[model samples]
Target chain A: MKSAQRTTRRPLALAVAALVGLPLALSACGTSTAASSSEAVTEISVMDYYNNEPDKSFIGDALTKCGTQAGVTIKRETVPGKSLISKVLQQSSSKTLPDVLMLDNPDLQQIAATGALAPLSDFKISTDNFAEGVLSAGTYKDKVYGLAPTVNTIALFYNKDILDKAGVTPPTTWDELKAAAAKLTAGEQYGLAFNANPTYEGTWQFLPVMWSNGGDEKKIDTKETEQALQLWTDLVKSGSVSSSALNWTQADVKDQFMAGKAAMMVNGPWQIPALDKQPTLQYGVVKIPVREAGQTSVAPLGGEVWTVPQTGNKARQAKAAEVIACLNSDENQMSMAKVRNTIPSKTTLAEKFAAENPKLATFTELIKTARARTGELGADWPAQATKIYTAIQTALTGNASPADALKQAQGQ
Target chain B: MSLTTDLSQTAAPSSGKASRKHGRPAGPPTEAQAPRRRTRQRRERIFQWLFLVPAVVYMALFFGYPVVKNVVMSFQDYTTATFFTGEAPWVGLANYVTVLSSSLFSTSLLNTALFTIGSILGQFVIGLALAIFFQRKFPLNGILRSLLLLPWLLPLIVSSAVWRWILDKDSGALNRFLGDLGVINTGVPWLTSTSLALIAVVGVNIWIGIPFNLTILYGGLQEIPDELYEAGSLDGATGWKAFRHITWPMLRPVVSVVLVLGVVYTLKVLDIILGLTNGGPANSTQTIATQSYDLSFHEFKFGEGAALGNVLVIISLVFAVLYLRASRRAVDE
Candidate 1:
């Protein structure tokens, strides 16, 4: 009887082991061997978040070209935009960080502060002719850790057909903006649409209005910020902007404009390629409207920056820095700017590119005054950005008055 | 001093007392048998442990490490810097204090409770109704029952995205349907409204959860013997009366399992809410899970995020213990 019971239990035990062991075996299989320094560095690993098509292929080609020039093969890994930072943190903890890394500009300071990125000054890379805002975005604690090949900023993108049919010009000031939006409001289409969701994108979109109105991220409770908040509040309350703007991303706002559900939207030049695809859609770009006519539009600087992560391999690091510098070279910058529809990071290159591509001229001009989101606050900007978007959502949803919302969020 | 006597001395107490009542004589081992028996027993114990090794290792690596790390991190000043430098200063409940004291914490707690309760209640009730309906013999019954699994089978993110479009204020199918029926002239801001966002999210969750509940409850329904129903009918217990007397009381065990599991799963739902509203429209749909995610990923406050996560785990643990006790009671009954 004991032997019979043992026979039955043996199969069950084996089944249980197999069930539990399969995933363990699979997970163990995943740890790839990294290149040892003893061997000559033949390949350098690069990680970035341009997983989407067009940008993915575009950046991939550039990386390959630059990698060839630096005498190393590029092994690139692309992740979704949202997951990049977490992946980096995981890689950092494991000491498996890639030789080359890409970070969204505002995130560079935070990552650099963590001591995960090497200063470009170590490789003696030149920073001449680079846009001041772009340079500032890449700087943390008096050291530049990253550099961008191209940069972009949000602007007022108007559906020209709707504006033409309505005989309304694109608004240059907040008053005209409100008037044009209210007048264009009819049927299913809203007069204007912009994102005010509780995310950093919302904060970025709101900055053009806030900064142009002389509002400061350092002190968001100022009267200038409140006025900007009030402008957003008034637009939503008047039914000119949809209540749905509270949940819309910039992509959704662009979709609304493209489908003629919105007469205009606040977006960036990255959307130009998608817009240019639609032959029937007549659109025009302008600097985001200022609170008053005399105010200069101050949009937030938006772009990705490439950096050499501290992988503890000097030769690989040097090669990675070479690739980064090559990416920002004038030829690569101009070509990438044309194809990607972003302004070159270098002022001279950007000016020449804008003169050639009139459609991006408005964005190029805005990039001149564009403030880096992390310029003043450094790594603390994320906390402030959360507050800004929270205030925007609260005000837009009518949960509180703009002034009250700003005060409450500032205190939080 | 001989091998037989030594073997008998070691194995007698452990094996004899239990076997004595079964009429098996406690005999002394012979010299040749003693060595072989001892080796076999040792081998059996080794084999048993060998079977457990894989499971133990798997649990230690996957579940145990992450949970212990999360608990420890909650008491430290863990941040992006800690990931690089491997230095997380011990803060001793400072993270818990800050997370608990925040205004959003209260909102998230309340939302979590509402979301879990609302989703479970709707899922259980509707799921039971569908289970009972499917129990009846009908044409296309099998096909219809399988089709009901579609919502659960689809990826949560995909379902949420589709629901977002279907619930859009201006051009949503729901609004169009309502408009055509003359029930409402204007489209309802189902997901975008502060008042309705949580409810809409709960509605979507209920849709996703129904298939699991239905499949389990339907299996419970199938377990009831035909004689019980026949006897109940003869005793003038029919339909709802039969259901209350025979079906529910018999399905009690399965129901408890369904409800407890539903509460636990719904408590930690992140993807659907993130995909649909992202705890937005003025922080209306914000739950503990989403708030924890935002704390870590968006704000880079890993300590606070871990603290919030531990709080959620504690909530789930309470439910888990209750489930254990409830199951014990059911077994006794």
Candidate 2:
């Protein structure tokens, strides 16, 4: 009996040792790794490029819905959009990538070239179902590599109550915009929220107003760019807008708007939820005012695409694409639209949303003329954008003129 | 006979002749001394090999291999397409020439030098003052010393974050408090202005550096003999004169050590920059450390980034060599 007891204890001791040492040895292999587990499971990694925590839970819910529909248990992973491209590059070199990927509009090129993403052209749904510009965005060269999951457009958000009180119509031209902005300029309230600082809040901002008037950085000497810049600088010079808040963010503009301090703000429909929560202010959104008489009311598009890494098996890639399709189905799109506060991508479902949701219908109408910035070709674009915005910032601060600023950007 | 036998066994005729150039007597025949010496020699050899293995292995896998690979990569024209999947196109010395001639690279070098000089000098002066202050017997010296250490002890991310809040123009507590005291009429754009952003970040870095410098220098000052000061005073010296002749000479070795460390630490600075403006406000504050990150992570130009990194390593190495030479000279004198 004593001999038997000794025999049993040796194996148990060795098993305990193995348990203690295994995980440490494994973690040392890499910073992160996929550990295949028994029991039915599918792993999917999504990019929450903005690192928005609320959206993480939204992805979790959407995947759960899709998993139920597909009869598979899906595991989810998320990476911030900024460094996610680098991480993908590191993994792609070794031919290992997550089963599913979420491609931000900017990162589509990097991953498509990495040879790690499987093409989504073979998926069950026809690619034509999505909006033209967004569908084009998810395609790299001639190949469609991702699905247009969510579509959005830019517009001018105005406080309805303030507009009525001031007895001013929403501006449709440069002159009218300046005049209306002057009329609304009273007390602490700004005539229009035009503080473009850093990159995202600024880059395409004053540029769009200029572009509408036939201005462009490429066409440096155009009157449109100068006129648009003048409109903004004039607002600052007139004291209708404060240069002190020149480096402010969209959040800052939203803050001033919510308090009924700013009558007009150029923003996308993504901000509708925050604006809707204001108890005192009544608001309406419209096509962004144009610089030229016949020019379309132009706004920038903000959207996302679902991509599959090439490392994933083709069948699995097809299944993931199908799952993405199911998630963007009419009911699911409506579910997300309720939370996203933006227009859905699908034409048929979009009609359903417009029929039922009044605000969404108004947003869809504006989408007819909205545009996306030049599709990013170089990875340097993000950095280039920040630099260009700073140039504009320099011009705004009286350190440089619009011509000087544009010249500096051209040199870079 | 035993000594001669051991010497005969171990030393080649050339080594024995080589040993004579330093002017040591060449007779060998001490039997009792031979084994104890041999055992000690054996122990030292084993220890030398043991100590060398970890360092060699680390250098081979991480440092040596990466550098060799990087130099090879510098000859290639790498884009996203050619970087990971296909054979890279060789570009010879074109990358090196491009980097050397580029205005951005030159600007980055200037920024790095300015940062290094400012950080080192500021930390050294402040640290010395704190060391002297702490040396004096004062009430709550222990508590005050602990409080001084807070800046160095706090995680860099947290420290930069706190500084960001304090330096904020409109809503910062600093501007509000200073204005209340009539220091200024309005808040300064401490971060947004390109001219001021570099200074602001350097100030924060200097603040973080103070406690570390104080701690080490104070410990060093305590090791200095009290009698040396008395001896100097008896010879009729006081104040700055006394400090210059007696204190500074005594503190030279320690000061040299601190400056060497300061220079090396400043060269690798990245976390503080990342947490602040990410080397922005028009790249005015972009240092060698930040440019490395931008080139490698942001642009995927790893070869150029590695070369830039090697430049920093070389700068630190030169400073270290100078410090070592100074220490040896102090010892000999």
The candidate maximizing TM-score is 1
TM-score for every candidate vs. truth? 0.91, 0.80
lDDT for each residue of candidate 1 in A60-126, tens digit (9 for 90 to 100): 9999999999899999999999889999998987789999999999999999999999999999999
Give the per-residue lDDT digits (tens) of candidate 2, residues A258-313.
77777897766777777777667688877667765678665555677777776535
lDDT of 2: 0.69
lDDT (10s digit) by residue, model 2, range B153-252: 8999999878866876655677889989999886676765677778988888999899878988898899889998888889988878778998788888
Name the top lDDT candidate: 1
Where does candidate 2 clash, by residue pair? A49-A81, A116-A310, A117-A309, A117-A310, A118-A310
Angstrom error at residue A285, model 1: 0.7
Candidate 2 predicts chain B with a TM-score of 0.81
